[model samples]
Structure formats: structure tokens, C-alpha cells
Target: MIEDRELQLLINDIFEYYGYDFSGYSRASFKRRVDRLYQMDGFSSFPEFLSRVRVDEAYFSRMIEEITVNVTEMFRDPAFYAVLRNEIIPVLATKPFIRIWHAGCSTGEEVYSMAILLKEANLLHKSLIYATDINTNVLDTAKSGVFPLRMMKTYSENYVAAGGREDFSNYYIANYGIAKFSSELSERMVFSQHNLVSDRSFNEFDIILCRNVLIYFDKDLQDRALHLFDDSLATLGYLALGTKETIKFSKMQEQYEQLRKEKIWKKIR
Candidate 1:
């Protein structure tokens, strides 16, 4: 096992060399993932792994995929979506045009879910969903709007629980063990690479859903991310977070009002 200080230095070196910053992530999680990568790659020492990462661009990409967490599903924590349906979407409908930012939208499941929700609400044409993540590969998968057919059953259940009005199957076509969603759902969407740790806010938004992405970040980085969200959101805009994430400890806590049981906050200040 690499010593703690040495491992941290290696992480910093990757940031300096590759412009990929993981310093603000939880050290324990970073260590665990790095250790797993070391074992899986059969590197005799940590330094050997570092050497491969520094020189081999392909290996560095593989290393990033290993270290970053991207666990997500369609309509995850369905209650949250239900809240959005019953409460949030109605107010958003009042707007002439709605802009939703799905920060760290891994593989675009939730983005599609939001698009489907807006479609059912008769607001899809008036809305644009910007889905972003640090991983370009996942963004490519998201842009493709295709998923394994086997996961459809569960995703369908989640859709129903999230107050979906139509047959969930109406959203996609299944063939050869793959499901391709309708292009209509993807037409008003844009997928891009965005690193929360380093990227500045590009546009103001009415709603930002950054679910299940911040639990990996430590305090300072979490605060930095929250500030970025703050800067990106318009006044009275909605901000939704993962079930495990909270804004109570954040510097911007007082700037928002908890609007729903889920971690949905509205910027008031």
C-alpha cells in the first residue's frame, strides 16, 4: 500500500500534469479507487502506476474512469421526481422559457426523465435541458440516448412511481437487447463536458439538478460547488441535490429556502 502522503502527492501530480483535479474529493474514496486500480492493473508499485499514467494518455483515461464514480439510474429516488411533478414543474410552466441544468448528469438517465416530464406537462418545446458531466465518455453515451433493454423494466417502474402519465414504454423502442429513446425527448437537450471542480459558471438557470454527485466531494470542494451553483442559478431558481447531500453546512445555506421534502431549495437572496 502506498503511504498516505505519497498517494496525495501522486494525485496532485496528476492534476498538475493532466489538468484533472481530484484533490477536493474524499481522500478515503480516492485511495480506495486508486488501490483498486493498482491491483486491477497488476502494477508492482504505486510509482509504476504513476509512470504509466504520466506517459500513457490512454492509460490516464482508463485511470480516470476507474477513480470517478458515476452511479446513476432513471428517476432515481422517485419521490424526488414526484415532488418535482406535483410542485416544481407547475411553477416552471409559468415561465416563457425554462432552462434546466443537470449538473453531473451521468449517462443522461435523469436528463431524459426530466425531458419526459416536461413533455407530459406540455412544456417540452418551451424548455431546454443542459446536461453536463466531467466524463466525456458518459456524455457520449448520454448523447446517444440508448440504454440496455434489460434495465428498462426497473426504469419503467421508477417512471410510474415518479407520477409519469403515459406508458413508460412509450418513451423508447426496444430491439436486440437495447432501448433507444425517442429523438423527440433528446432534441431539446445539449450534452457537454463540465468539471465542477475547475469550471466557472457559464449560464444562469431556472432549475439545477445535481443529484448523487457531490457526496464524493469534501467540505471545501462541496462549498465551491455550491457557490458555483449559486452563481449559475437565477433568483428564485430551484436547486435539487442528491438524497445524501445537504446545504445546511454550506456558506450559501441562508440564501435558499427548502421548498420540498427532497433536497429542493429555491434561491431567495
Candidate 2:
């Protein structure tokens, strides 16, 4: 395991050299990720691992891919999607155009899911979903709109639970253990690399979803991300987070109103 001091050193070095700040991430989670990489790479010592990380750009990229959490799947938290369909989409439909930002959108399963929702509501032609992640590797996968064929069963179940009525298989074409989603869905999505820790808010959005991501950040970073979302979200627009994440105790809590038992919040201020 990497020592506490050594983990801090790694965080400092990464920020100084790569301009990627992991300083505000949860210490335990960050340390565990680094240690996993350190062991998997068979580094004999901390200095050796640190030395390689410093000298090799490709290795640094590899380290980043391993360290940043990218675990996500389609229609995660079916109930949340149900709420979006039942309560949120109807209101958003009143607008001329809808823009949504998916921060830390790992592999973009939810973004695609959102596209399906808008399509069902007949709002896809006027809606654009911006999906951003820190890892370029995951961004590429998200852009492809391809996923393992085996995962479709669960995703389809999630879709139904989220109030989807159409045949889920119609959304994708299966080929040799891979399911490629329709171009219609991918056309409305824009995937790019974005670091929520250091990046500025680029556009106003009707909805911003950064689910299951803030749990990895320290309070300072979590607050920072929430503020960015607050700035990016249009007044009265909604911000959605993971079940365990919230803006309730943050400075922005007063500026937002939670949507019942779900994690969605509307920016009232």
C-alpha cells in the first residue's frame, strides 16, 4: 500500500506535472486506486513507481485511466429515470430546446438513456446532451455508443422499469457480443473530455446529472463541483445526483430545492 505521505506526494506531483488535480478527492479511495496500480504494475518500491509516473507520459495516462472511477451502466437507478420521465421531462418539454450536461459521464450509458427518454417524449430533435469525462479512454467508448451484448438484458429491464414501452432491442444492433446503439441516439449526443475539478462551466443547461461521482471527492471538491453545476444550470433547471450525493449541506443548498425522495434538485435561485 502507498503510505499516506507518499499518496500526497503523488497527488502533488500529478497536479504539478499533468495539471490534473486529485488533491480534493477522497484520500482513502485515491490511495486504494494508486496502490492497486502500483501492485498491478509490479513496482518494487514507491520511488520506482513514482519515477516511472514522472518520466513516462503514456504511463501517466495509464495511471489516470486506472485511478479515475469509470464504472457505470445503462439506466442506473431505474427509479430515478422513472421520476425524470414522470415529472421532469414534461416540464422540460415546454421549452423550445433542452440542453443537458452529464458531468463525469463515465462510458455514457445514462446519456444514451436520456436520449431515449427525450425521443419517447418527442423532444430528441430539439434536445442536445453533452457528456463529459476526465478520461479520454472512456470518452471514446461513450462516443462509440457500443456496449457488451450481454449487458443489454439488464439494461432493457431497467428501461422498462423507467417507463419505457418500446422494444428495447430496437435501439441497438447486436454483433458478436457487442451491441451498437442506433445512430439516431448518438447523433444527439456530444462527448468531450472535461475535468470537473479544474474546468469552468462552459454552457447553460436545463439539466445537469453528475450521479455517483461526488462520493469520490472530498467535501471541498464536492462543494466546488456543486457550485460549478449551480453556475451552469439555468434558473429553475434541475440538477441530479447519485442517491448518496447531495447539495443539502453545501452553500448552494439554499439556492436549490430537492425533488421529493429522488436525488434531483431544481435551482430555485
Candidate 3:
């Protein structure tokens, strides 16, 4: 069994070594993930586990990937895309140039979804997307824009339901049971590694999509992230979140009006 004090030391060591702060993450989830790592590595004690992780860079990278959850899909929660297409794009169409940010974009599915949507709407040429995540492994996967071809049938249905005009097959080439998305879609996007917990905001955006990534954080961390979004958004800029996540309890709630239940919010000032 790993002692609490030893767990703290491990956490501190990770932060000091990698500059990735897991300190603000939920303790229960963090501990559960670490425990799983211990069992997988056959370590009976936390100290031994910590020493092994510290000494092995590849193992440490793998452990970070294990600890950071990266679950996403193309056109996830179709309704949110529906809302964006119906409610947001019309307004965005009026802008001369648009800058959108995808914070904590796991494997780039959502980023590709947005890019396809913008292209279909005839707005892709005018749009610049910044897709960021703390996990470099996931970011690299996202940059590849390759996904399981078996999943495309379901994704195609989502695309249509979200008001897609063209055939979904137009977006990618299918080869050996994998779908490789077109470079055209990726050309408009800049995928990079960014830690929302420790890094400051980089650019003001017309729209920010940070879905399903905040639930792992505590309220204080959530609030801090929201504040960063608030600062990074232009006046009346749009904010999108996961179905279960919301700014309702944050200090920024009053400053942004709920555009689509808890799915989207628009900064008022």
C-alpha cells in the first residue's frame, strides 16, 4: 500500500521533473491511476514505484499518458455540433477572420470535426484553429488525423445529424481499415502541447471548445481554467464545453450568457 506522504512525494517529484502539475487534479482519481500503475509494474511500495518512474524517462512518459484521460470521438455529442452549426456559424460567417481554440483537444477528432464543418460552411479558408493538449502522445496522434475506419459509419451519421451538406466520405481516404483525414483539413489547424493547469493563455479567440476535460479537475482548478478562458476570449466570443461540464458555478457565469443550455456560452462583455 502506498502511504499518503509517499504519494505526495511522488506527485511533487512529477511536477518538479516534468513541469506537469497533477497537484490540482482530483485526489481519488489520481490515486486510483497511480495504484493501477503500481499493480501493472509489480511494485509493492510507492517509493519503489516513484524511483523507477523517475529513473526511466520512457516509463514516466507512459505513466503520464496513463494518468491523463484521453477519450474523444469525431462529431461527439452531435447536438453540440448542431447548435454550433445552427446558432454560431451564421454569426461567425459575418466575421472577416476567425480564430478558434480547442483546449484539451484529446486526439483531434473534435478539431477535425470543426474543420470539416467550417469547410462545408465555406468558412474554413478564413478560419485558423489552434488545437492544444497537455499530452504530447495524444497530440501526435491527433496530428496524424488517422482514425479507425470502422468508426466512420457512425461518424458519418453524426455529420449528417449535425447538418453536414457533403458526403462524409469526402473527408478522408480509407486504407487497411483506417481512415486518414485529408491534409486540407489539417492545414488550417495548429496542434500543440499545452498544459491548461500551469501555462498561461496564448491568444484571444473568437471561439473556444474545451469539452470533457475539466471534470477531472477540482472546483478551484476549474475556476482558474474558466478565468483563463474568459481572459482569452474576445468580447461576445463563444465558449463550448462537454455535456456534463458548465460555467454555471464559476465566477464567469454571470459574464457569459448560456447560448445552448450548458453546452455553449457567449461572453457578453
* Model 3 clashing residue pairs (backbone): none
Give candidate 3 regions above 4 Å deviation.
none
Task: For residue 113, give model 3's deviation from the true position in Å.
Answer: 0.3
Q: How much is 151 displaced in model 1, in angstroms? A: 0.5
Q: Tell how far residue 40 is off in model 3, in angstroms.
A: 2.0
Candidate 1 ranges beyond 4 A from true positions: none
lDDT of 2 by residue, 100-203 (tens): 99999988899999999999999999999999999998899999999999999999999998889999999999999999999999899999999999999999
Q: Which candidate leads in lDDT?
A: 2
- Give lDDT tens digits, candidate 1, residues 1-269: 76798788888888988898899999898899888888888999777878898899888888878788888889888999999998999999999999999999989999999999999999999999999999888889999999999999999999989888688998999999999999999999999999999999989899999998889999999999999999999999999999889999778999999975679999998
* Candidate 1 to truth, TM: 0.98
Evaluate all candidate structures by whole-model CA lDDT and list the values in order.
0.91, 0.94, 0.90
In angstroms, the error of model 2 at 91 is 0.5
Per-model TM against the reference: 0.98, 0.98, 0.97
lDDT of 2: 0.94
lDDT string, candidate 3, 170-204, tens digits: 99999999999999999999998889998898998
Deviation from native of the Cα of residue 230 in model 2, angstroms: 0.4
